[model samples]
Target chain A: MQRLDPLYPTCPIRNVIDRMSDKWSLLILSTLNQNGIMRYKELNSAIPDISQKMLSSTLKRLEADKLINRKMYPEIPPRVEYSLTNTGQKLMPAVGMMVDWALEYFDEITK
Target chain B: MQRLDPLYPTCPIRNVIDRMSDKWSLLILSTLNQNGIMRYKELNSAIPDISQKMLSSTLKRLEADKLINRKMYPEIPPRVEYSLTNTGQKLMPAVGMMVDWALEYFDEITK
Candidate 1:
């Protein structure tokens, strides 16, 4: 386990936690992890509540952060697919663990 | 790995993500995970920037969520120390992974 130096003004822990904790980003990453290589429409349908604007923006951010890769295929309509990068894949075990923990304590948390 | 049904509106994933994603809450949880039992002053000094109201409220929320246990000792000043519960301890590995990932990609993310 890494010792987080709390005194550091610009700690990477906070930056990474902030990104992972973003509800949409977390949900999106989890979704991508389960169903590999999702196009824009598939992603939108999978996460039904996300607005088109939000989905596009979030995807851009994730791609920028290198957590997900956006592949634009040269088709007549230009198909774009999104999937996790190696770094993103490495991060999912942690997410999976959190999901397990959440489900384990769901009743207590919701009560 | 839990299959998060994004279709499920009240998913535990979202609930957990929302709670964990709150910046102050994440920082506080990380601090408690690192420093074990901490009083209000210790916690305040550890995170440094959290306001009194925010710290008090965030701690209450975390305790209510069963993430941390707060013990108030009867003393001249009535000392209260905070530590993670079994569930919270269970969740720290995930947080630790996130910190590791963040540190690994700090320059890329910041650039």
Candidate 2:
């Protein structure tokens, strides 16, 4: 028997869902999964609809959650890149399933 | 390679995230997963904080997404029950993983 207590906001499942189930986060994950490491500009272009503000905020949240690794290269221009951590990679399978589920039921849901 | 185009608003992945990533849907899924079959009142009690309106709306959305099945018994008092469908059941593994991931990083995220 699993201890499912998502009734509380502090529940682990609730926390994960609150962070991972967003459109931008999923999109960001997909983008990172496909492109390997990406800079802010790369992520911005890859996800066309997200605003700069949204991207920065989401990236900060994802990093804070330890889902992604943000590396800052302090060069002349200070290049920064983002990629999924082991934990984030583990999350991809679930995301894949959700995408598959969505695709399978797209017609039914849309109609 | 995996057709990861969650960029569009109408995209299936986008649709799924928008619908399923909310706190209520996750709670509803957790409740249904544990209880197997539940009535509206059962779901309400299981998730203490959700408003009646939120529960009703989320249930309707989940059914529309073909994730859960809603069966209404038109008896003396008219009972209604909800449970995950095949698709919904398929989603549980991913949800389980998310919960596991969250628990692993709870301290880091909370602090």
Candidate 3:
């Protein structure tokens, strides 16, 4: 029972799984993987049905986790682009597998 | 853009990914896969740091989503056990991949 909390001192794997399983985190990573680097507005436009607030919040969280790099260009219109960091890039394979799984097995599961 | 929201009417895969990526759903399925059938209290005991409320809620969600089968026995103590459904079993490969990915990549990312 005590082993379940990945946050526990002994449970080193917990945090990693938690981050990967995060809802918007994986989606944001997938979007960036497919599109390369994208600006805030671009991402928002790319991911339909995501509220501005959710997008902003999700990006901030991803950036803080160091999974995505946020580059801000100082200009009249704030130019902020998000790309996967090296660490984030390493995760793309796993993320890609998940996306593939979704595409391959969704119909079977639903039907 | 419109293609990103898997939940949209046109997005058939949305619901499947949503269910698999659900926080507790994957974990419960993994636990069941490894241990076969486990009673409610046994599962609660097996997964450390999960609140009873969360465990109960997560189990109910998995059951409702048809990812797990719940069986209740008539006895002195309530005997409710959980196991993966066929749909749930089909998802194990993907879920196993995720767990493997976590174990393989966490050290790289965190370092």
TM-score of chain B for predicted candidate 2: 0.88
Q: Which pairs clash in model 3?
A: A1-B48
Tell me the whole-model lDDT of each prediction, alpha carbons only. Answer: 0.83, 0.79, 0.71
- Which runs of model 2 end up more than 4 angstroms from their true locations? A1-10, B1-10
lDDT by residue (A49-93, candidate 2, tens digit) is: 898999999999888777799999999899999999887887787
User: DockQ scores for all the models shown?
Assistant: 0.43, 0.42, 0.29
Off by over 4 Å in 1: A1-10, B1-10
Across B9-71, the per-residue lDDT of candidate 1 in tens digits comes to 367887777677666877898899888889999999887778899999899988988889999
Question: How do the residues B31-76 of candidate 2 rate in per-residue lDDT, one tens digit apiece?
Answer: 8998899998989988778899989988988887778999999898
Top candidate when judged by DockQ against the true structure: 1
Highest lDDT model number: 1
| Order by TM-score, highest first | 1, 2, 3
Alpha carbon lDDT at A30, candidate 1: 94
Candidate 3 local lDDT, B3-41, one digit each (tens) = 233446434445555565556666677889999999988
Give one digit per residue, the lDDT tens place, for model 1 in A23-82. 689899999999999999999999888999999988998888888999999998999999
| Chain B only, TM-score of each candidate | 0.89, 0.88, 0.85
